[model samples]
Target: MIDKDRDTKKLQWNIGTGVHYTLNANWALQADWKYNYHRNTGARDRLWGTRLIYRFGEGNKYI
Candidate 1:
């Protein structure tokens, strides 16, 4: 059965976090994670990823 009520409401939310680390004056590392919550559909999704960054010009940086 499907609910056709026009007033029906569904709840959804997303939460995420990310971290950035400086490996050197011109290099960096990044990582991220995220999660999704759906109340009405009872479905969830998760994501994670990592990235490497590089700088073209010199600056007061490095890790």
Candidate 2:
């Protein structure tokens, strides 16, 4: 059984990036994601997700 009455310090940090496909100058589709790594334990965490981006005016576009 899992401990329901426990206090665990899940201290970690995240640092990552992903490539994206530019559908247009205003819209884009990307595989944007990130990860969390435990600082003290050196254990990797599966803390990542997807994102949708919309831009106004051209600046730094990626594909």
Query: In order, what lDDT does every prediction score?
Result: 0.86, 0.69
Cα lDDT of model 2 by residue, 1-63, tens digit: 246534454668987888777677777667756787886689886645565778877834653
Per-prediction CA RMSD (Å): 4.3, 7.8
Q: How many residue pairs clash in each candidate?
A: 5, 0
lDDT of 1 by residue, 1-63 (tens): 256664487789999999998878888889999999998889999999999998888943533
Residue 28's lDDT in candidate 2: 67
TM accuracy, model 1: 0.69
Residue runs of model 2 more than 4 Å from their true location after superposition: 1-15, 39-44, 57-63
Q: Highest TM-score, which number? A: 1
Q: After superposition, how far is residue 61 of candidate 2 from its true place, in Å?
A: 8.6
